[model samples]
Target: MNKEEANQTQAGKEQKAPKEMDANDLPKVTAFQDEATREYMVSTKEVEPGYYLLESKSKKIRMLFPEEGKYSDLLSNFSKNEEIIGFDEYDKEANILMNGQITYYQGQSFLRKTDTMIEIISGKNKYSEEYQKENKDNTEISIGYKKSNFDNLDRKNNYSYRYFGFVKPNQSLDEGVEYSFIFTCKDDNQSCSLDEKIARDKVKKMISSIQFSCNKEE
Candidate 1:
């Protein structure tokens, strides 16, 4: 080709290069950084013994016992002090709490004794007498325990322990929302009825007073 034609051809190729380039070859551009964006990250601050502030996404939740040692120790002690009767396993498949054969439906929280009784705590509206009646007809009688403070009482049997049953709300539990429940049962002969009642009352009072704080940024 002639020199002049070759030069023109090269210029045309260069002009088209910009349009033909892939997205990765484009000049780097960035959205301007803002002070507000930095605020989205969570911040840590000590609130008190066994509590720390966690700030994130313009919101804050007081993380109880941020330090592993302190937090774990508190949990251990609490378990020991509260004579935990039993734990309800989380049934992911059923989306409910399971204790042996008894399956408390979702939204219905309870603390109960094996073959004794179950104490329905929150979400009572979801619980129906008909459901209980139908379920009770089975050979296994799922006894429901009432709210009690069996945790602080002296250990009388291998089975006696404090327990809290919770059924998380359909909506997410807000950061500041607090929950509390209890479980207690009488001996086989119902001999500890009076003592159990007193202990349960004390626990109910203590749990009712638990307060939660929510601090989310505007």
Candidate 2:
């Protein structure tokens, strides 16, 4: 090829080559910049009994309540190695709600608030072993919620939130186990009392409406 043509070809190749991006030139991209980009954001229809859905700027997660145990496993997973700051328990009949604090690397964090409800059905005293003899299983249900404040050194009070639901039984059943429904809501609002009340009311309505009977049995 001619020298001029060769030079032109080299220039074209250089122009087509990708430009190098320096650290300064890299675009600053934030995670989940758009809510629609989230992988698991819960929709109104996805919300159901015995489930907890949590969302953050970049992450969304859901926890489903199994059919018998309290919130012990749920709390364990959530607060693994974290410090406990506040804890309170309230018992009414066969139900219980426990609220507490969990601390992680980011200083004192709030549990937002937690509620655990347990119901015992078809269980007997250890001495009698009646539930086992009667071929019945012990059923328990629980729900937990946690709200964490965002770790912002510049901002005074920014926060994020999480929720958990669980259920377990003494014995696995051939039929699907019954689960207690639980739901939680978190926002920038500082009034825990109002938020707690609303969350409780909503969850209660959900639980009350659930039908555990099988279609065949019906």
Candidate 3:
């Protein structure tokens, strides 16, 4: 090949090469709507000696978390990783959820948990594209907890936690943009998997405490 032709080929390859994703473009902890709003919120007094009440600044919502303990520290850090047991809220448009009804929103397939139940599911092959496609049209399936009922597809109980809940609607469901709550272990943590009772208790308390302003007016 000629020198000029070689130079042109190199330039074409460079142009076609995909750019690496910038760190800033990546989803940070603040990308979570609830965690971001907590920055501007007023810290409420402890609900009890060991638990403190957490409130959202804009949303009429409140929950309790451990005041001082290992769990407290873990929950405080909003960074996404495998070890931490934390909850996150984001706009439904950001379809990063898994395991449930596969529906299309804005022409993109989203795996949404229609049931308001907490369950421990196998992380094995959960991210496989084939698994997703298999359950794409399965709406009757739900992510609900059953005692000693582990649905490990590969017979490996490498479990992850998930509790998906939708915000309470004011009047009509179509009145406003809806947000979903994802209380998860983020990945397969053995400790998180075994601590189901404690996690379920705490999450139940938090969800029960949630009170909407619109509901109060009605």
Candidate 4:
């Protein structure tokens, strides 16, 4: 083809370029920065470097590194031995907890003394036998959202699950800090209705899309 004809054809193709995708399709995320902590939340994607973030009316997470043995930084503290300071917000009147802490230890005794928990839920088994047996063939790890339901361990009105197992900063496993997360509503009769189920699902969706990074600034 002639140079002039090729130029014209290229111009025509440029004019016919595809339309831009909607912002909704990309997953909307909001960033949160506090004096000692910073995090991000996505409507559809985890705010990342870590696994997930929980959606709640109130959001706060504290990252800490003990001067002693194993430590965790803000940028990479999923289930590491390092001490992390995070809490679950609760609606006292409704008796609803926004996100439950699955990790039982912060790796430092002194730090744990200063950090108090709002709520702590315990289970009988470390991992659900039924769930492990059912998905024995699946080697790939499963990340859950509102639709993903793990073992509740026969707890009435409780939605329980495990966070992505402890991922070290170097991405090597020394000790698995695989923690669990839970959502439950406290009612007069101790039963979860459709409303409670829906509420938990919303929180789960928030958790699935949660991600974070370190704020290195002093």
Candidate 5:
């Protein structure tokens, strides 16, 4: 082909650069920025409306929750030593609560500590045998349940169903933080049990998606 024809063909094949996204167009849970440098520390890809694939550089954590609107951030001051987060629901006077705690204690395991606490509070062998699962990414999870009878006059305030979960992440320097998740509900009615099961399933889904890495901010 002649040089003029070749040039015209090449120009025709060239595409325009995509437009930059406006902050207003982004999803609410899509990304979190660092206050210091105004840089993005956490980002997420929208899998579908209201669902995202979230990744965090600061926390070294990644998880996707479809029911993200239901959760509330309990801890604002994030720390390496300890942090807590939770979500709760009240329907038909049934209260269902789920919370997770992460603790960094070098080589210590939080599983034994939680087990001891459960035994002390509920008596020995009060909790059911652990249901354990090992994920392919080197995360280990153990689940168990215990019933608690609190001396409270208000039935709404009485906590009955106690579910505990221990997560052990893959080991390394500054490895995984010890994680514990507690799910609870009032044993007041059949609606409570149904909500408890639904919340429990959501917890499982959230835990299964968790991944810890050595991601660090520059």
Candidate 6:
């Protein structure tokens, strides 16, 4: 081929190289690093007394939180990974919660436990009876997942999310224990330019690398 023609062909190939790349070949999303923080690479955190590590081995994340409720013996926990037990809690005064429980219907993994006795007349139950009634008949589903949704139950100024589900059945997590991951704004005003949606995406992206384990911790 002529030199000029060969050069043109090589340029064409270079242009098509990027377009020819498969979407599946792209790297997995890691949004956690978009903003810098000392807390990245969670696997390196030092454990303090009375706290345990909830590490995502695949993701290399390790979070340390109190093993039991502060100064309380009413330990509500989930039997995770045979030997690893974890629990969820909420500080009513602070309007903050960590990994709370949610129940689901059959084939479904999350359901708001029915309060058949609590009459909604006084407005304690925001869910209309018809809404409750519709779901009440839903058979308790087996293993499944529900997309995590950001929530501010206490109407705290901070933004956060809760998720719950059973990766497996038979061993039901306790009523109060939450099966979710959560993130709270460190500052009330959230001084950053990133909007709430972007923040949530970052959190989800960070979790994408994590894989839940059911076996005992070594």
Identify the leading candidate in terms of TM-score: 5
| TM-scores for every predicted model | 0.22, 0.25, 0.35, 0.31, 0.52, 0.25
Candidate 2 TM-score over all chains jointly? 0.25
lDDT of each: 0.27, 0.28, 0.32, 0.31, 0.46, 0.30
Query: Which 10-residue window of candidate 6 scores lowest in summed lDDT?
Result: 132-141
Weakest 10 consecutive residues of candidate 3 by summed lDDT: 129-138
For residue 170, model 1's alpha carbon misses the true position, in angstroms, by: 13
Question: Is candidate 1 or 2 superior in TM-score?
Answer: 2
Estimate candidate 3's alpha-carbon lDDT, on a 0 to 1 scale.
0.32
**Which portions of model 6 miss their true places by more than 4 Å?**
1-178, 184-186, 189-194, 212-218
lDDT of 4 at 77: 35
The digit string of per-residue lDDT tens for model 1 on 27-87 reads 2211001222112212223344422322222222212212111111122211211211111
Q: Kindly list the per-residue Cα lDDT of model 6 for residues 116-210, writing each as its tens digit.
A: 21222213323232321111111222111223334655533434543222222212221111123443433343342323444344323222222
Off by over 4 Å in 3: 1-41, 66-143, 146-157, 167-193
Candidate 5 structure lDDT? 0.46
Q: For candidate 1, which ten residues in a row score worst on lDDT?
A: 29-38
The C-alpha RMSD of each candidate to the native structure, in angstroms, is: 22.3, 18.4, 19.3, 14.5, 8.9, 16.2
Compared with the true structure, the alpha-carbon lDDT of candidate 6 equals 0.30
| Candidate 1: segments with Cα more than 4 A from true spot | 1-158, 167-172, 176-194, 215-218
Clash count list over all predictions: 17, 11, 0, 9, 0, 15
Q: Point out the higher-scoring one by lDDT: 2 or 5.
A: 5
Between candidates 4 and 5, which one is better according to TM-score? Answer: 5
What does candidate 5's lDDT look like per residue over 1-218, in tens digits? 99999999766444211112334434443232212211222333455454454433255666653423333455322455444433333333444445554333333343345444334333433655655555646666555555556786566646555555555555443334344455556355445543456656655665666666643233
Off by over 4 Å in 5: 1-24, 28-41, 47-51, 54-57, 66-77, 80-97, 102-131, 153-160, 171-174, 182-193, 214-218
* Candidate 2 lDDT over residue span 117-157, tens digit each: 11122111111112111111232333344455555545433
Per-residue alpha-carbon lDDT of candidate 3 for residues 1-218, written as tens digits (9 for 90 to 100): 99999999977654431123232432232321233333322333345654554443334444454432112232433221111223333223322222221111111112233221111132321321111111111112222232232466553444444433322323322211112222333333222333556545544444444444334554
* lDDT at residue 84 of model 2 (Cα atoms): 19
Candidates ranked by TM-score: 5, 3, 4, 6, 2, 1
Q: After aligning candidate 1 to the native by TM-score, how far in Å is the CA of 20 from where it should be?
A: 70
